[model samples]
Target: MNKTVIIKGMSCRHCAMRVEKALNKINGVEASVDLESRTAKLNLTNSISNQQIIEVIDGVGYEVVEIIDV
Candidate 1:
């Protein structure tokens, strides 16, 4: 499954990397963050909640604006 999350406050590559790392910490989740679009593309091999993803991103000082299953 794939999900696209719109995020805010990502200013640069470092910010993008931070969000990517936080998402990747979840089991069966692979994330790539793009600062240009202020979005994160996630690949999931297992079930995970949208709130979980939001919390993870929020925990790292970023904000999840929206989550869309794709």
Candidate 2:
């Protein structure tokens, strides 16, 4: 399964990488963050909640603007 999360406050590659790393720490999740788009593409092998995703991002000092299953 895939999910696209719109994020805010990512100013550069480092910010993007931080978000990517945070997401990847979650079990069954792999993420690629696009700095230009302010989004992360998450590939999941098991069930994970959108709220969980949001919290992870938030914990890293970013905001999850929206989440969409794709």
Candidate 3:
């Protein structure tokens, strides 16, 4: 499944890269972040929960403000 999450605290390309790296560390995740939009789009091969994603983001010091179901 694929998902898009609106994230806060990303202010530049470097921030987006860090967020992407953090999400990619998840076993089944293929992710990318757009600095301009401050959003992270993720593709996954297995079932994953929003809480888990939130934890990952929070663990890396960013906050997830919204989970978009696209």
Task: Give one clash count per candidate, in the order shown.
Answer: 0, 0, 0
User: Is candidate 1 or 3 superior in TM-score?
Assistant: 1
**Candidate that scores best on lDDT:** 2
| Best of the two (1, 2) by lDDT | 2
Worst 10 residues of 1 by lDDT: 8-17
Instruction: List the lowest-lDDT window of 10 residues for candidate 2.
Output: 30-39
The whole-model lDDT of each prediction reads 0.95, 0.96, 0.91
TM-score of each prediction: 0.97, 0.98, 0.94
Better of 2 and 3 by TM-score: 2
Model 2 root-mean-square deviation: 0.5
lDDT tens readout by residue for model 3, 1-70: 8999999998878888888999999999999899888899999897899999999999888999999888
lDDT of each residue in 5-62, candidate 1, tens digit only: 9999999899999999999999999999989999999999999999999999999999
Deviation of model 1 at 9, angstroms? 0.7
Model 3: colliding residue pairs = none
Model 2, TM vs. native: 0.98
Question: Which pairs clash in the backbone of model 2?
Answer: none
- Measured by TM-score, how close is model 3 to the native structure? 0.94
